[model samples]
Target: MKKILNDPKRFVDEMLEGLYAAHPGMLGYTGGDLRCLVRADAPVQGKVALATGGGSGHLPVFLGYVGRGMLDGCAIGDVFQSPSADQMLAVTRQIHGGKGVLYIYGNYGGDIMNFDMATEMASMEDIEVRTVLVKDDVASAPAERAETRRGVAGMVFAFKTAGAKADQGGSLDEVEAVAQRTLANTRTMGVALGPCILPTVGKPGFTLGEDEMELGMGIHGEPGVRRGKLETADQIAEQILATITADMPLNSGDRVAVMVNGLGATPLEELYILYRRVHQLLADQGVSIHRPFIGEFATSMEMPGASITLFKLDDELIPLLDHPAHTPFFRV
Candidate 1:
């Protein structure tokens, strides 16, 4: 339960302040009340604006993706909490280019409700808006209705694809189509090694024994599918990869992108350890790794865990993915 902060109540604001200070060229606050971080020179004339929002604990999820080739703006809420409708509308107003805006975020209830309200508000202003929800966590729901599954790290790919499409002067409808396609092709599952401490609570959100690991855990410390004795890195990778592959069924000659993401506290060395096994497993499946990104692309505070996200890419997606993207948190 150790943290460095002046006051727990001000943790969100203070953290945003520090982030802006560190990357002033890339981030800034909007209208003061709305915790909106937009590209310093946003509303890029004729391009459709891409905006996403969610809780704050997951670094690089909602905020870190705001950059030149990603989201145009992002509304950040408190840790693991959804932003208010007004906040979303403010970001929409700020980033609305002549073209319409697209709201791409997770399928969590709070986000859905708030973004729906925001969409209605934006309509009143004659600003067209479209929404896409990422539902890629196969472990959260049955395959018969996989769309009900929760969104995880796969949202990153959606952001990149949608942004690249918009950057290339695609219509708002076209950009939304690219994002939806990316989500449909993505699937993810995660394992938790330890719980994360909320900044306000100053205690672990949940408990896990030193020798036990939880499979299929949510990023917000939600219960996972199973708990068992820790196993070798290869065994763990196999378990996760099998679940993802079974749900998606990558065949021989299939090309895909792999994201081996750390929850939070898992170091780079350990993530690479897991990635080694993941690489071997994918090779054994005869699947070609198109573009591999391994790091803390998404995280839950200081939680110790990792997730695997697979995007079965097609011809169009491969180039959009490879398109140059430069952000503080992601670069290509």
Candidate 2:
């Protein structure tokens, strides 16, 4: 496998070190645990603290959103592995303003368990904790069971929405409420044309035929709902939009926030080609887009694919999404 690193065992550690080096003024760490990254100006005295985390390899995900108006702190784990509860606890302690802390993360089994353990640990120290699990990937479960679906790129909206509320000095409950609301209004579907090689694993865990694609695949190469021959960009876009709309069913007067996200290796030009179709599809349905985002908001190492996320907006959600944020990776 062709990878860039000194030691696979040190991949997570070294990556964090590099992140700090690249943005020293904007990023900092909880003293002993390098994995717990925080905004340089953390524990803002009066504002609610927001913390989110997950495995590494998805840059701008658990860590990339750390800054003034995004995550106050984040607990990072090894690639595709949940961060330890202790790591979560350390970040909690680092960013706990008297206003309390809220933990926002994707809805994965390991992430949920570890974050829960950290919440319990924080309660022992009298730190109030709240959580909002993002479960927006439509392909992971039936429409009747969205709560069971895995969170994907839709969380970019979650982080921005909830972080804006917190940055506005909203209480922990208020922040948590907005986080859940944002998640509830979001849906995501992805298609992967190739696979990614994990450094430690030394190879791709799953593979696709040269002329094949997997629809609704997870960021870590989790099985999607379908596997079939590669289709044209228009066909792929139609399949994704059909599946998402069948579940969510945007109406004629509905408004949405569209995100065309690259899984990792998908080029920006290709992403726009896909987004053009997404825009047209929504327009044809008479749905208005608020602000369309296009880029690699979330990734899976070097995997070649993309995911589309639509955030249904209401009168209340529009402002929260447009709130200004200053993060190392995300700015709004």
lDDT values, one for every candidate? 0.90, 0.91
Give me the overall lDDT of model 2.
0.91
- Clashing pairs for predicted structure model 2, backbone only: none
**Candidate 2: which stretches are off by over 4 Å?**
none
After superposition, candidate 1 runs with Cα above 4 Å error? none
Highest lDDT against the true fold, candidate: 2
RMSD of each: 1.0, 0.9
Tens-digit lDDT track for model 2 on 1-332?
Answer: 88889899899999988888999999999967889898888888988999999999988787988887778999999999999999999999999988999888898999999999999999999999998998899999997887789988999898898889988989988999999999878899999999998889998888899999999999999999999999988888899999988888899999999999999999999999999999999999999999999998999999999999999999989999999998878899
Report lDDT (Cα) of residue 123, candidate 1.
98
